[model samples]
Every structure is written in structure tokens, then in C-alpha cells.
Target: MAMLNKGDTAALVCCSNGLRPSEKQRIDTLADILGDMGIRTAVSAVMYAASTHYAGTGKKRAEAFMELYCRKDVRAVFDVSGGDLANEVLPHLDYGIFIREPKPVFGYSDLTVLLNAVNASAGMETYLYQIRNLTGACGDRQREEFYRTAMGGSACLYDFEFKFLRGSGMEGIMAGGNIRCLLKLAGTPWWPDFAGKLLFLESRSGDAAKMATYLCQLEQTGALDKVNGILLGTFTQMEEEGCRPRIEELVLNITEKRGVPVAATPQIGHGSDSRCLILGRNYCLNLQGKTL
Candidate 1:
């Protein structure tokens, strides 16, 4: 495991493509928290590129992020916020540079675009967790654990509780993130090969039937057939009325035919409670272990 060395630093890349002043302050709070954890960090200006007001800054935004990617001193890259421009910067990214100098990358939502692209192109594992542009939500233990797993290089234990909906114990390389993000990459060269892996996923605000529809898409694309198991995070701010079935019940229904061990409501996704998950890394989700 490549742990964060005693004097190592973490580079903060805010995907601000466009950000509010309040958002900037949130990124600063993230930096301060990391600093308190004794990890050195650098806050770059990828923030401005995310706003509708900054449509013309795409070229400059890519250049800035590319520059940070090349810096040897940067041990890891953390995104500040996620919006729309990440896809714009995708084609401009140098995957070869990241491969040559691989480091753990972290962020979610819009960052999902970047994570899937990098993993597809460079074969380096990335993280899907709390965004850097949020404040006062994550606790210290969560922060320390996340950094420890991400920068404290080396495989760590990850046995989070899966409110088992149908199947039982299983283990494999973990993959999958935001439901929409995963679906977006479908049919693209960037879509991950999920065969024989644990396909962990969660979403925000979608009701059970909508969740079922997305899972069906994954199944139609043969994504479901590739997993060794399934783990779901809470659907934050989920609505009760959608003329659809219950979300958890829907998940149980989808995976029942696959007969794969399925777990639900694990500590993850679109909430302050979202825990860190290493994409492309091997993990075990079982009983009597580190159940979240």
C-alpha cells in the first residue's frame, strides 16, 4: 500500500468550471480539514470553469488541470466541486501523464465523468466520495479513514454493511458509482469491464421505480451479468411518491434473477454520510468484518 508518507502532500483540484463564492469557501474548508489531518495540500483554480458564466474558459481550465497533473510533488488530486464542464475537459486530458505518475483521484457526481475516463484510459484506481467543495458535513473519523485509504497507499479493509435484500456473501474487485454516471458511460469505450466484479452503486433522489429502470438498463447492457455481488448506498433525499415501488424492493427484484448476493443501504452516495470507495480495487463485503 502506498500510504501518505509522513511528509507527503495532497493536491486539491476544484472542478469549479464555475463556482460561487460560498463554494470557494467550502473548498477552503476541505483544504483546512486535510491540513488538520497533517496532510499538505494545494488548492488550484479549476473552480471558475464550472459556471454557465465561464463558458469561454474551457481552454484555460484544461491547461490548469493538466499542469497540476504533471507536477511530481502532487501526491493525490481532489476535486473541489462537480458540475458540467468535466466532460468538456475529458478529451483534453493526458491519460499517459496520469499513468506515468499515478495517484489516487477523488470526487463524485460530475467527477464521475473524470473518474470513469481516467480509469478507462490509464487503468489507475480512483475514489468516489465527498466532494471537496462541501463543509461541516463530514466528520473527522470519516476524513481520516478516507485519506488513509486513498493516500495511505496499500489495500485496506472495506467490509461495509449491506442491508441484504436477497443474496448472501461474495467478494471481488469493486466498481460502479452514481447510477446516472455509470449509465452515461454505457456503450462508450470508457465503460468499465465489470465481469466477475462487485458492482457497488447508489443514487440520489430517484424513487424505486426510477431506480429499477436504471438497473434494467444496466442489465440490458449486460452490466448486471458481470458482477460477483452488489452493494447499495442510501438514496439521499429519496422521494416517497413517484407512482413507483419502494427503492429497496426494486433493487431486490432486479438482482433476484441474477442470483448474486446483494446488499443495500451501505454508507455511501450523495450524502454527508458517503464513505470512500476505491474504483478498480479488490474488496470483500462480508459478515464479521469492517461493516459500515
Candidate 2:
């Protein structure tokens, strides 16, 4: 049980048990670093094992996380790691707790499942940003800028750069994370209502065409068409092979054709230096590229 004051951030070491002994050290190191910086952290081996996509870690760990969430000392919550299995925990989680006590929940990639599900179910604000495991990236100016921009807002406002693709700046509730994870939400009850949102999405590495397909699915679900704007965060480090249509081309062509204001690359998701995005809230995206 970790204690955090109003401004203090609480770190949650939710993993999928796929980590090795040395990787555990990495998580511990992260906790220490955050602690040194005055952030509170808690480590739970249960969620680590539960995060594995195919690990089948089960409801026990998810229940444990829910219990931790009920703690009164917790301020902001962040996942210590991402794995393949957070989607499994979504249904099992006491998601109502998040709505009753809204706090920042931060994580990218696999944590997207939890973030999306909770936001949609509870109508609470969540964050799409680096967790304790990767906050060291805060040393970077661009990264820090992204985090601060989103956090500084009283109700989730973003002041990051947006590369204009077709439309202009628009404000709406933000909902999106790892593109792959968003696609996985298809046809699921956990999938949130993305209607009338300022959708933001970023990916690390994957098949570009498949990404397009996923985007199309968002369109089919009315998520894309329902958004006031679309912001594409950093897609970072693509595989040398097996990525087709090229992400840039696919994204640009699709978003432009969809007739939605599209902005790309200001940094967010799965990169050594990931930016921050606030989900399930409203924000204004001003897309510009001028150096100071």
C-alpha cells in the first residue's frame, strides 16, 4: 500500500509475469527512481503476470489491482509495464471504482485496453503517456513538453504540435491509444463510444496496411466519422520487413480521404521518448511546426 498526497503520483507495478529476474530489477529501479523524485509506487507481481497477452493470468490479479485502486492514499495511477494480456483484466476490473474516484491512469500500448475500457465505462479521464518504467525519458525536451502540456490543463488540454493533413484544429473528447490495441477492441462490449471525439492514436511498429485496416474499422464503427479531429502521434521504429504500404502513406491517404482534420507526429507511444495524451476528455489540438 502506497500513500500519495494530492500532487503526488502513485506508481502501480502491474506486470504479466513474463518478465525475467533482471527485468524485475528494471521495475524496481523504476520504482526507486520515482521514489527519489517523490512519487509513490507499489509493486504487484500479480498484474505483471496478468499483462501477458496469452499468459492467461486470470481474474485473481485483476481483482488484486482493483483492491489496490481502492486505496485512499493513491493520487495518480500509472502502470509499471505493458504486456499482451491487459485486455483480459478489463472485464474483471471493478471499473466503477475509477469513475467514483477519477485520477490520472497512465500507460501506453497494452495498457490501452484498460484505459479505453475504463474511460468508456466510467466516463472518467485517463492518460496515454509513459509510466514509471519509462519516465526516465522525461530528460528529453520534447517528451517533457508533451507531458506537461497535457497535465497542465485543468481538464485535459493539449498544447502540442499537430502537422495539418486535411482539416484544422478542433476540440472534442480524446479517446485512443496503441492502434493495435484499438483494433483488438473491435466487436467487444469493452469498446467505448468514440462518437464525437478528438481521437488521437499512435503506434510503435506494425504492418502499415493492417493499421489502415484498423483505421477503416474505426470508420466502420463510426468512431472516425464521429470525431471532431484526428491526431496521429509518433508511430516510431517500424520493423525492417513485414510492414507494407508504409505507415506515413497509409495514414495520410486514409485520414485525408476521411475528411477529418488530421495531425501527425509530436511524439506519443512506444518510443524511447514517448509523449503524453489525455484520454476521455476534451482538448484543443493546434497543429503547427515553428521552431523557437
Candidate 3:
């Protein structure tokens, strides 16, 4: 069912880090684009707020998120910022508030922490996508998909491209994104169950060394062993900078002979043309399948 009507409000939240002065334009552009689709925006109060490196204290950020969820006028919540501070707001989140008449919650990168937590605790659908992406080079398609699915209440159509890295026929509930951000759930109450889940990963920034270390840690947690397969998305900075020890190479070494199915796509992650992916849902993937 459609979560929004033509005149309903969709919220833009910054539950991670404060926006830089210039990023405000980016937000405006996003709102204008959505406005063209007849959806009004209700930006969160704490979006531009800051306390040194964060949007605010964890308590404040959590409160802002809860407030948005509780608003009857808000049809959906979209987080617009990405920073290392996202996980800090996790503990302060009142999971119960999310259960009452839940709306679709959307985010990506560090927002992964929020997406998975809500899915695990509240069983509400969450999106692993950056709303700012609507201003990107792929804006047209992004906006199309957003309107068709989120606003129109139609099923999703996978429009990105991918190629297999290990094996084929990887299928299971989608979980994980931005390896570093996902790992923040470790030892926390919100950590997702990995058993038979299709682990998806992408990155906005992080070098080969950082990825190697992250994979090592995740491997040690035995998550790798429990997942049904793995899917790699664009490793933006590393891919653009031509960083050595490419993510695919390191992943191959880390799982050497483990027989985990793996695939990759440059059409997702922080790419200019990145597409959206749904979290906490059963997905059957292949080089050609279009619907998830």
C-alpha cells in the first residue's frame, strides 16, 4: 500500500551528523525534486544542528528520530546525513516508538545502523539508500523508482547492473551495508542475525587496508560463516582512487575456498548512479533477475 498521498509530507532527517553549510543546498535540491512529484517535505529540526562532530548528543538525535516517527503528517522518514556518529544514537533510540503505525524509514551508509536496528526490533521495512542521491547524475531514474515504489506503493524493480565474483544463485534476506558502519552493531543489542542472510556490502570511503581489517574482524565474529552469500557494491573512494589490494581481491583472500557466493555491482553504493536496495527482505539475486 502507498505510504504517501500526493500532498502528504515526507520527512528529511539528519540523525547522524550535522550538515555542512554547503550541504544545505543539496537538501534543498532534494526537497525541490520531491516537490515536483507533489510530495511536500518536513525536514527534521535537528538536521543542521551540531555539537562538535555530531548533530547533537545521542539522546537528542534519538529524540528527533522518534519525534518524526510519531508525527501523523509524516508519511516516511529519510535521513540525509552520513557520518561516523550514527551508531552513537543507537542506544538512545526507543524501539517501541517505531512500532506504532510505522512508516517507511530510509537511509544508507552510516544510516545502516538505524535501518537494520528498526528492521530487527520493529520488523518495519527500511531502505538502504541515500535520499541525497536524487540530486546525483542518476537522479532521473532514482526519482522514478522512488515515486513508483515509495509513493505509488508498487513493488521494486532492480535497475542496476552486477557481475558475479564467486558463484551464482545467492539468495536470502538482505542484510548489512557500509562494512564499517554495519560492524558498529557488533556486541550491541541490535546486531542482526546473520544465519542464512544475504550479506550485502558497499562503501563511500575506506582503503584496502581498512577493508582487510574490517573483513578480518567480521570473519572472526563468525558472521561470515552463517550468511548464505555475499554481494559487494561499489567501493567508491577506493575504486576511484585506484587503491591497491582492491576490495574484491581482499574478499577473495579472506574467504579463500570458503564457498560463499559473491557478486558485485558498480551501479550501487555511493556511485553517482547508485540505485536503492531494500533491507530485511527475502531476495533472490542473479545477473539477470530484475525484481527482488
Candidate 4:
């Protein structure tokens, strides 16, 4: 059976930034699209609330998220907003709600905070994805896969295209996302245990120097040495701007020394062509004859 069935409702919430007035129309359009796919959507009441750039206070946002999960008809929760305030909700979230009534929640970028937390807290698979991608330039491609999976025509939503950056035969349950966002969990109870995990990192924005600073911190904290491997997703901004040093140089410079197998995939991250990565699910490297 599919995780979501026809007529099931999906909740769209804002975990970080509030939606601008201009974006409401986009949500309506997305609702129409999902409707055509035989699914329905319920937008969070506080999705447009303004509290100094957040949709609402952390406690309120956390409450709203927990409420959605309690709904019997809602099979999934999709965070449609991203920014700096996501971590605020982390401290306020009721992990017990997630633990007792686990569901597939999806987000990326700053929502990485919730993705990792839900996985670590509840042992449920959370997705690194943006539901809003169905309205982007690559909407046709994204929407097709989403429809197929949502309608129970396919068992998998991810169509990954990855290449070995160095070494091979590395595979494990995935963790990590948005280089900087994952760091927000550093000292928190929500931080994922990277031991025996494939630490996947990506970024929508960040120059080489900024990435290096973050990477050095990862190394210093001994996180680099703990993970079995690292997967590099599209560094959108740096790649598009042709930034110096490049992400590969910075990542390889640090991870290579740790003897961790590394792989690269441009098919994920902030790109319009991006696909989903199910964190906490076992995945093996297989592209180009690579195997775990």
C-alpha cells in the first residue's frame, strides 16, 4: 500500500519563515495541482503569521505541526518555508506526538533541522525535499514522480543519479542536509548519531570560504571521523556563481583525510531538478556499477 492514498490530505506548514503575501497564490496553484493528483492539502493557520519574520512563535509553530500529525486524514506534513528560524521550533517541538503517530514529513534547506530531529527522535524516515518544487521550472518532471508514488503506482519517489567522488562500496541510512542547518543541532538532544550513517550535505547558498569554515568545525568536533561516508549534493549557489575553490575541493580536502568514502550527485538539493532523499532509510551506492 502507498503511504498516501487517493483522497488523503497533506498538511503544508511553515517551519521557519512566514510566507509573503505574494506567495499565497503560489500555494493555491499548488493546491490545484495536488488536487488534480487526487490528493488534498490543508495549509497551516499560522503559515502567513508574522512575528519578526517567522510564521509565528516557536511554541505556536510546534503546536501547529503536532496538530497536523494528529489528524487522521493527514498522512504527510510538508514544510513549505525555509530560513533561519527553523531551529527555534526544535526546542519547542513535542517529539512524543511524532513518536506515537509517526508519518512521513518532508522539507529541505533550513527544514533540515526538523528532518534530522524527527528521524533521530522518532526513528521515522523523513524526506529531504521541498513540496513547493511542483511549481518550479522542472514541475513536470517532479510532479510526475510525485503523482506516481502518491497514487500507489510506484513504491519509490527517488530517482537518484550519483557518482563516486572517491573510494566506493559505501552505503548506510542517510543523515544531514543543508551544511549549516544540520549544525544547528550540534548541542541539542535532536542531533543525529552519525556513527554508521551516510552523512549527506548540501547547500543552497555559501561560498567556498564559508563552507570551509563549517567543514573545519565538523572536523574539529570529530563528526567527520564518525560517519561511515559522505554524500555531496548540489551546492547550488556556489556552482551557479562559479565560486572559487569549489565545494568538491573543500569537502575532499577535509573528508579525504578522514578516509571516508565520498560521492557526488547534482540530482538533489536546491536545483529545480532535485529529487527526494529519505533520511534514516538504508541506501546502497549502485550507480555506475558502484555497490555498498
The number of the candidate with the highest TM-score is: 4
- Higher-scoring candidate on TM-score, 1 or 3: 3
Each prediction's whole-model lDDT (CA): 0.69, 0.65, 0.83, 0.85
Give each prediction's root-mean-square deviation over alpha carbons.
Answer: 3.3, 4.6, 1.9, 1.7
Model 2: ten consecutive residues of lowest lDDT: 150-159
Instruction: Score every model by TM-score.
Output: 0.84, 0.82, 0.93, 0.95
Give model 4 RMSD, 1 decimal.
Answer: 1.7
Query: By the lDDT metric, which is better: model 1 or model 3?
Result: 3
Residue by residue across 1-292, what tens digits does model 2's lDDT show? 1223334657474633244444666677766655655566765545433343332354765776766677777666667656566676766887767777876777778788888888888888777766642446444454345334434332212335557776656677888888877777878987877667877777776666667777777777877667787777766645446465766567667666567777676556676555567687677665444221
How would you order the candidates by lDDT, starting with the best? 4, 3, 1, 2
Task: Return the number of clashes found in candidate 4.
Answer: 0
lDDT of 4 by residue, 1-292 (tens): 4677779999999888888877899999999999988888988987885336867788899888878878999988999998888888887787878888888899989999999998999898898999899999999988988877767657445767788878876878899999899988888888898888999999988888889998998887678888888989999889989998988888888876677888888888998778888899887885455332
Candidate 1 vs candidate 4: the lDDT winner is 4
Q: Over 4 Å off in model 3, which ranges?
A: 153-157, 287-290
- For model 3, what is the C-alpha lDDT against the true structure? 0.83
Candidate 4 ranges beyond 4 A from true positions: 49-52, 153-156, 287-292
